[model samples]
Target chain A: MRRMAAIIGCGAVQVGKYPDRLESELALDAVRMALLDAGIEKGQAEGIFTTPDLRGGIGLQANLLCEYLRITPKSMAEMTCGAVAAGLTVKTAVNEIMLGQIDVAVCYGAERECSIEWFKHFGSALFEPVALQPYASYGIIWAYAMSARRYMHETGAKEEHFAMAAVRNRRNARHSPVAAFKAPIAIEDVLESRNLCSPIKLLDSSASLDGAAAVVVASAEFARRVCPKPVYIMGWGQYHDNSCIIPTDRCDKSISSFVATREAAAAAFRVAGINPEDVDVAEVYAPFSPHELIIPEDIGWFEKGEMVKAIETGETEIGGKIPVNTDGGLLSRGHPWAVTPFYQTINVVRQLRGEAGENQVPDARIGLVHCEGGMMNNVFVLILGSE
Target chain B: MSKVDFAWPASRHTPSGREFWAGLKKRKLLANKCQLCGEMFFPPRLCCPACLGDRLEWFELSGKGTLYSWTEVFFAGPEFKTPFLLGLVDLAEGVGRIASRIAGAEAGELKIGMPVRFTFVDAGEDFTIYCVTPDTG
Candidate 1:
């Protein structure tokens, strides 16, 4: 008797800074293809959610997109939570559909990070735009460096432990066409790369590239009639942790991510009436490799400090007991902030339907997707299944 | 002192940094406080999102505050030069504040938890802003 939500169609456009100034074109094109993929008419969607492109002006982006596409939604919202915003949008739309607010919903994101000129154009707004001009990029680097430093101090995890994750993810990326950095890397390579921030090198971070992704979500009855293969949203959770960036009286060892993920996992499992063991695949947002350790431990996949052992033993790989980030993850797949999480959900939807060709898990009936945003600002987890 | 030049957008809300500069004239920092939730909004908000509080109270904050966390930037912005320190200052009224360029220090002497006061500098082109050491420090 549980209501099901399904992603009927998905599309991605890789403009790749080719024309140097075609973000609007790329965004509009992605929207068209997504509607086509879902087999839904362009004008039928009732809700539209967008993740703001760093290149576009704040309020202008959403309305501009609506105008360009020539499709208007009864309700529209812009998601600013960076990478996880897309999946979160889907969750929001699904809730609204269940609540009888809308029928079909569209979520998408686009950016041109490869062009330095575009960044400088927008860099004028910041009062202090030197050294670390885009302050948000520093969040990932700092989070990793700080976490790695603390892990090293407490659990004896070396730089190599973190480096190995990059190697594995890059290896996974080799199989993916849209991945930003498919080229394999070594421990020495990571150590030698230019430091964006201390303890996090160039190789540890995802590339800032131009691309777009979109998905369509609808209610159970609508999905059953309109779509051939509908993946049920078995469980989902989102959490916000507003705390001091630097731990003052709070425990530094315990991050806001743990607090958020634990709550999300509990809610998701309750909704699905399942446990951790029931999950077959996991796609988590790890822009930095060190998070490969912290997230799994937080979700109880492994004991504290055991993620390194899990990675080293190949237990978290494609053929492992529980494959993770089979879609190359944000580190390899390129983190577009808003688009990345939907990519995670799309990967799950494909795997559940047995449509994932080379990287698919054979009998993955249940899949888990996790996205952490805004310096651990929010944690959103979704559990999907075929039944 | 040597001369410096900077570029900025002419915005009506605070056309060319005038919004922040004008507040310092009365020795007051203007912020939008959410009337419903009782939380102060920094950089001024059009509305309070938590409670859908449309009406915001524009109030002047007392310039007194305690230095939270800060870092000295060796590299500077176009409007700002090197040796500027950015700090998250907690006001006496229990709200967090973000400001740039702790002036009157030689970069090497910056410390966390140091007491500081706010100040303004007219860059002549637009408006240059900074925080300087307080008499209490």
Candidate 2:
């Protein structure tokens, strides 16, 4: 495959609770691990990119990370495009490398979201100030939960049908060392779980964890020398809607399926010069079960409302026609806020490299990794491949 | 950025919503109307999102609409009581939508597109909050 840029290395700390560890420390650890994986020293990282630290509440985190690493790079940026920031950070490096402005760039994120009450006020603030009390918007889950109802109303999907995706994602987490919840959950368990919102059970939501992940992207010329099996940045596309979670447009544009994801997926596939069937594996960011169903459908791998059958028939598991979230998605794998994209990218890269031991999809030459921010309002889709 | 600082009730209050907050206190539902484009929207904004027009007016709303969607939230911040219902509504005026707590009916009874009316209540001893209820009348 032709290279837009190439991923030389990716490293992630086991995503779980680290009540005592500062986010920067975990960030440095992940960066160092990635440098080691790429067989490059800190000096080789000519660029640094990161997302704003939500847990630490610090601005310009990438600058702080550069200070922590004690390396001055020619290019450095902090991409804060909400939940998709980590992926966009890496994509920024990919673009930088492709532009020949830098030979190597290290993009990373670290989040300690085990506490600090991740969502509420942040969700409200997304809707501007007046929404704080008047809207009662609260956390992002309410929006997704509400969307689930409209999704069922449109697709004839039952709550049980949606819970099955959670069951599948958890089942894949058993072999994943970085995953927080490796214990496989039954469909009944998901159905009986405590409801955070209607049809979205506790198991369907991500386990808030504290961890960090980093990816090193290098120019194709630089990667060919140091890294033997590089995951090439085949193509990527990004699109977003102003309707963060609860849309002013209602189901006409906001809910039934993610319009942004569909458009972004189309753009990504067009750039990759590959169709949905060509993707052997995927790591889609689905913090909730309905998102899991909506993503594959939006990606055009399955028809709308057809993800339920794909999950039940084992068509979406590892070794299936377009295996998804092989390392367990956010549902069971754990989500350390911004670090999630790095973890997902690492999983996709590893699957392409045949380094994903038990979760490996057989001969995964092409892969797709999708990231979402702000209730699927901001979407970024990347299609990667291995030569 | 506090109630003491801004004299607003919400822990995180919007500074541009003085008239909207005051109107709520007087039990009048208000939405931002773009003076130029004449577009009305909920949760008032300083600049109109439609026309980017700074000249805006506080238009009183009838508070009657249809339920667009909703949920039963069991987990949220410390301030939110568990298992409260939130509803997304489409205004009868056809201007915009609102997301707020739903009242006056059971969760099972609420359906999409059902006629709903807004009701203001004084809560937390600070300011007024609103709820969307089934408009049986």
C-alpha lDDT values of all predictions: 0.65, 0.81
Supply candidate 2's per-residue lDDT for A236: 85
lDDT of 1 by residue, B17-47 (tens): 3444466445566656787888665554456
Q: What is the TM-score of chain B in candidate 1?
A: 0.72
Per-residue lDDT of candidate 2, residues A127-224 (tens digit): 56326454464577888898888888778788887788888888889998788888778889999998888978888788777879999999888989
TM-score of chain A of 1: 0.87
Let me know the TM-score candidate 1 reaches against the reference structure.
0.70
Candidate 1 residue lDDT tens string, A1-387: 145677787777642444565666777777788888889897888888877766555656768888877878887888776456776687778878878898888887666563344332333243221111122222224434544555554556776777777777777777665677777777788877765544556777766567777788778778888888878777787776653232221222243136766777777778888888788888887777777777777766777788778878887888786788886787778766566776777777778888878887878989999987654547888888886
Best by DockQ: 2
Worst 10-residue lDDT window, candidate 1 chain A: A129-138
- The number of the candidate with the highest TM-score is 2
Docking quality (DockQ) of candidate 1: 0.07
